[model samples]
Target chain A: MFRQSLAVTLINLKSIPQRPGMSIATIISVALVVGVLLGFSAMANGFRATVQGTGSQDVAIFLRSGAQAELNSGLSRDEVRLIEEAPGLARDSGGEAIASAELYVIVDGTKRSSGTDANIPLRGVGEDAALLRQNFELVEGRMFAPGSNDLVVGRSVQREFSGFEMGEEIRLGNNNWQIVGVFSTGGTVFDSEIWADLGVIQNLYNRGSGVQTVRARLENPDAIERVRAYAENEPRLNLDVQAEQAYYASQAGATSDLIMYLGWPLSIAMAIGAFAGAWNTLYSSVDRRTREIATLRAIGFSGFPAFVGTMAEALMLSAIGGLVGAAAVYLLFNGVSASTLGGSFTQIVFSFAVTPSAIIAGIVMALVIGFLGGLVPAIRAARVPILAVHAD
Target chain B: MTEDLRQDTLYQLDHVSKSYTRGKERVDIFTDLTMQIGRGEFIAIMGPSGSGKTTILNLLGGIDRPSAGEIAFKGQRIDNLGQGKLATWRAHNVGFIFQFYNLMPTLTAIENVELPLLLLKMSGKERRRRAETALDIVGIADRAGHKPRQLSGGQQQRVAIARAIVADPAVLMCDEPTGDLDRESANSVLETLQLLNTELGKTIVMVTHDPAAASFAKKELHLDKGRFVEREALA
Candidate 1:
C-alpha cells in the first residue's frame, strides 16, 4: 500500500507543471494570505520591541497613586525630595542619589511630510537625568545648559518632525527654546521626545514646583520590593512605585494587543479566501482526472492511494506559496522604520520586525489551510467508482 | 460450444439480477441471468445497448456485485465480499481494458504498464523488467518512453493491453476495447488480443458492438435483455 501510494503521489505531482494555470492560481492565493498575516504580525512585534526596550529592571519609576502613565501623574517639590531620599537608590561620585524628577507634557508640532500639527512629547528633566538613564548618549551637538531655554531633541524627533534641527528655535507657550543637541537612547521610546530644563518646563506648563514622575537607579536589582514597600508606607509620599521594566511592558501590551485583535480577523478572512481558491482548484483537477482515477482503481490501485495523491498535491502547492510569501515579507519589511500613536498620545517610531517565529507560524497556517482545502476534493476523488472505466 | 467446454470452470453466476433506483423508480437491468466461464477460454458477449452485457463483465471482474444471486470465482463466493477484499481479488485475479485507453497522461508507456505491479511486493528493477516484457509481448516495446498523447490511437491501445497483462492475472475483461478506434487501429488491437489469448493462454471476456472484433474470440455469445439467445464456437 505504501508503495502504491508513493507511485500515485509522484505521478500526480509530476502532472502539476503540465497544468500551470490551475496550479498558479492556488499558489498565488495562498501567498497573498501568508504575506498579509506575516506583515501585520511584524508591525506588532516591532512596536513591542520599541516600547519594551525603554525599560530596565535596575531602575524604578514613582508615579502618583491613581495615575496610569507619567503624562497623567504629578508630584510636588517636597514629595519628589522625600522619594529621592528613600533607601536603596544608587549614588553618584559626589554621594548624591542618582534620581531625576521629570516632567512630561505634550505640545503641537508639524510633521515633516504633511506639515500638519501632531502631538509630540516635551519632557522636562533635571541635571541628573542623563545619569539615571544608562543608555542615553548625545549623538550630535551639546547638551542643554541648566537654567537656559535650550532643547535637546531626540534622534527620532529630529528625523520625523519639522523645525527641530540643531540651533533651530521653536516656540512653546510664551518662551522660545533652541534645539541645541540631538540624542539617542538605543531606539527606545525616549528617542521620540524633546528634552529641556526641568524648572524651565514646569514654569512654561504653569505647574510650579511640580513634577510628573521620578525615575531613580536602584543600587541592586532585587531591592525593587523594598523600595515599593517604602513608598507605599511613607505618609509624606502618596505615590505608587514599580520597576521601570514592568511599567513599560504594561504600556507595550495596549498597542500590541490592539494590533493583534484587529489583525487576527483580517488574516483569518484572507485565509478563508485562499482556502476556497485551493478547494476550487482541487475540485476542478479531480473533475478533469475522473476517468484516470477510475482507471487507477480498476488497475488495483485502491481508493487510499487516490485520496492521498490528491492531498499530497494540495499540500505541496500550499508549502510553496508559504515559503515564497514568508521570504518576501522578511526581505521587504524587516527593519523598515514606521511610526504610530502609542499609549502616551504621541507618535512612537519603530521598525517592522519579521521574527523567525512569525515565518514558522505563517507556514503552519498555510498547512492548515491546505489540509482543510483538500479534504472534500480528495474524498470525492477516492470515491470514484471502479466501474466508471466502462463509461463512454 | 459444449464440445469445447472445459471441466475446470473459473466463474459461476446463478440466478443473478441487477437493478438500480432512478429517482424514486426501480429500474431492473437484468433478471435471472446465469452464466458459466471456464478457465483459458476467450468469450465475446454481443448485445444491443442496455442489454446488461457490460454489467456481466463488471460482475465477473469483481468490480460490481450481483443484486440477487450467488457469484463464485474459483468456488469462492465473491458476491458477498466487501469492497476492500473485492479490490484485492480484482488486483490479483483480473485485468481490465477500456475503450478510451485510460492511461495516466503524465506517465510514459513503461510507467503506465508498471502501475499494477506497484501494488505487488516487487523491487523496482523487477517491476521495470516485467513491464518491459509485457510491452515487448504486445509489440510496443520501442514506444516505452512515449506518453499517451505522443502515440497513435493503435499504439496507445497496445500500451493499455501491456498494462492489463503486466500483473499476469487469470482473466482479462475488455469493455468495447476498439469502439473508439479506426478500422485499421481496431484490427490491430483485435490482433493483439487474439495473440494474448492464443499464445499466452490468458482467458479473455470482451463486450463489443463490432461483429468483426467479436470474430477474433474463440466463442461468441449473443445476449438480449441479459439472456444468452445463441452461442457459437468460431475456431
Candidate 2:
C-alpha cells in the first residue's frame, strides 16, 4: 500500500508541470498571501525589538501620575528635589545621586529614504543621564558641554536623517544647533533621539524649571518597588514609577498590536482568495485525471493511494509557494531599515528582521491553505467510480 | 449432459439481480440471472446499447456487485467482498481494457503498463522487466517510450493490452475494445486479444457491438433486455 501510494503520488507530482496554468496560478496566489503576511509580521518584530531594547531593569523612570508617556509628563523642580531624596536611588562615586531630570520635545526631520517629514524626539538630559544608560557609547566626537548650544545625535538619526554628521550644524524647529557627537544605544529607541543639555533647552525655550520625566538608577533591580511605594506615600511627589525595562515594554505594546491588527486581517483576506484558487486548481486536477484514477482503481489500486496522491500534489504546490514568498521577503526586506510612529508619537527607526519564527508561521499558513483546498477534491478522487473504467 | 458447466467454471453467478435508480424511477436491469463461465475461455458478449453487455463484464470483473445473488470466482464468494478486498481481488484476478484505451495520458507506455504492478510488493527493476516483457508480447516493446497521445489508436490499444497482462492477472475484461478503432486497428486489437487468450491462457470476457469483433472469440453470447437470448459457438 505504501509503495503504490508513493508511486501514485509521484505520478501526480510529475504531471503538475504539464498542467502549469492552474497550478502556477495557485502557487502564485499562496505566495502573495505569505509574502504580505510575513512582511507585516517582520515589520512588527523589528519595531518591537527597537522599543523593548531601550532601557535596563536596574534603571527606573518617573513620570507624572496620569502620564502614560514621557511627552505627557510634567515634573516640577520642587517635586524632582523631593524624589531625588528617595532612599532607593543609586549614588555615583562622589555620592551624588545618579538621576537625570529630562525635558522631552519633538522636532521635525526629513527621512533619508523618502525625504518626507517625520517627528523626531529632542530629549534634554541632565549630566547623569548618560551614566544611567546601559552601554552608552559616544561613537564619534565628544558629548555636549553643559549650557552649550551643541547637540549630540543618535547613530540611527544620523544614519536615517540628513546633516547630523559630527561637526555639521543644522536647523531644527527655528534654532541652529551644532551637531557635536554621534552616539549609539545598541539599536534601542534611544538611538532615534537627539540630545542636548536640559538647562540649555529650558533656558532657550523660556520654560520654567520644570521637566517632563526623570530617570534614576535604582540601587538594585528590586529597588523600583520601594520608589513606587515612596511616591505613593508622598503627596507632593505622587507620580507613576516603573522599571525602565517595563516602561519601554509598555511603550512597545500599542504600536506592535496595531501592526498585528493590520497584518492579520489583510493576510486572512488574501488567504481566502488563495484558498479558492488552490481549491479550483486541485479540483480540476482531479477532474482532469478522473479516468486515469478510475483505471488505477479498476486495476486494483485502492482509493487511499489516489486520495493521498491528490493531497500530496496540493501540499507540494502550496509548500513551494510558501518557500518562494519567504525567500522573496528575506532577500528584499530583512535588515532593511524603516521607521514608524511609536507610543510616544515620534518616529522610531528600526530595521526589518525576518526571524525564523515568522517564516515558520508563513509556511504553516501555506500548509493550512493546502490542506483545506485539497480535502474535498481528494475525497472526490478517492470516490471516483470504478465503473468509469468500463465506460463503453 | 455437457459435463455440468460448474465442473470447470471460473465464474458462477446464481440468481443475480441488478437495478439502477434514474431519478424517481427504478430501472430493473437483471432479474434472477444465473450464468457460468468456464476457465480459459475467450467469450464475446454482443448486444445493443443499454442491454447490460458492459454490466455483465463489470459484475464478472468484481468492479460492480450484483444487488442480489452470489457471485463466486474459483469457488469462493466475491459478491460480498468490501471495496478494499474487491480491489485486491481485481488486482490479482482480473485485468481490464476500455473502448477509449484508458491509458494515463501523461505517462509513457511502459509507465502505464507498470501501474498494476505497483499494487504488488516488488522491486522497481522486476516491475519494469515484467512490463517490458508484456509490451514485447503485444508487439509494441519499441513504442514503450511514447505517451498515449503520441501513439496511434492501434498502438494505444496494444499498450492497454500490455498493461492488462503485465501483472499476470487471471482474467481480462474488455469493454468495446475495438469500438473506437478503424477496421485494420480493430482487427489488430482483436488479434492481440486472441494471442493473449490462446498463448497466455488468460481468460478473456469481451463486450462488443460488432459481429466481426465477436467472430475472433471462441464463443459469442448475445444479450437482449439484460438476458442471454442466444449463445453461439464461433468456428
> Best candidate, lDDT-wise?
2
Per-residue C-alpha lDDT of model 2 across residues B80-152, encoded as one tens digit per residue? 9999899999998998999999998778999999999988878899999999999999999999999998999
TM-score for chain A in each prediction: 0.94, 0.97
lDDT of all the models against the reference? 0.88, 0.91
Model 2 Cα lDDT, one tens digit per residue, A1-392: 89879878988998898889999999999999999999999999999988998899999899998899998999999989988888799988887679999998888999999999999999999988888888889999999999998999999999898778799888877788999999988899998999999998888776689999989999999999998999999988869999999999988888988998999999999999999999999999998888889889999999999999999999999999999999999999999999999888899999898999999999999999999999999999999998877543
Evaluate model 1: give its lDDT.
0.88
lDDT of 1 by residue, A209-324 (tens): 99999999899888888888888789888888888988989999999889888888898999999999889888888887888888888777889988999899889989998988
User: Which regions of candidate 1 fall more than 4 Å away from where they truly are?
Assistant: A109-117, A170-176, B1-5, B231-235
Which run of 10 residues does model 2 chain B get worst, by summed lDDT?
B1-10
TM-scores for every predicted model: 0.94, 0.94
Looking at candidate 2, what is the lDDT of residue B145? 98
